[model samples]
Target: MIPPRSNRSQPLACNILRYRDLNRIERMFNRLKLFRRIATRYDKMAKSFLGFLHLTAAKLWLPGFVKRG
Candidate 1:
C-alpha cells in the first residue's frame, strides 16, 4: 500500500512582528548601555547594580507618560 502525499503548495504562516519586537528590545538594551553606570562595572555590589539598572529603565520608561500628560 502507498501513502498519500500532503499538499506542499501552502506557504508557512509566520509572525514577522515578533522580529520587530525583538529589534525594539535590542535597541532598548543598546540604549541602556549608553548610560555610563550601566555600561561600566562601577557598582561593585550586585544589589546596587540591579537597583541602578531599574532606575535607568524607569528613566527610559518615564518619557511616554510625560508625552501623554
Candidate 2:
C-alpha cells in the first residue's frame, strides 16, 4: 500500500492487512530469487521452469509440515 503524499488532493485509504500480505508475498519472491537456477532463468521451456518452480516452492514449504524426530 502506498502512503498518501502531502501534495495529493485526494488520498486513498490503505488496508494494513492487505499491505502486510503483499509484503509477505514480495518477500517470498525475493527468497525464490536466491536460487541461482530460478534467478538466472536457466530453463528455456515454460513447462520445465514451472515444474522446477513448484519443486523449489515445495522444498521451501515442506519443512513446516514434516516433523523431525
Off by over 4 Å in 1: 1-14
Report, for every candidate in turn, its global Cα lDDT versus the true structure. 0.82, 0.90
Which pairs in model 2 have colliding backbones? none
1-69 per-residue lDDT for model 1 (tens digits) = 122235646655555677678878999999899999889969999999999999999999899878553
Which candidate should be chosen as best, given TM-score against the real structure?
2
lDDT of 2 by residue, 1-69 (tens): 766787888978878788889999999999899999999999999999999999999899899999999
TM-score of candidate 2 versus the correct structure, residues matched by position = 0.77
Question: Which residue runs does candidate 2 get wrong by more than 4 Å?
Answer: 2-12
Question: In model 1, what is the error at residue 41, expressed in angstroms?
Answer: 2.0
lDDT of 1 at 47: 97
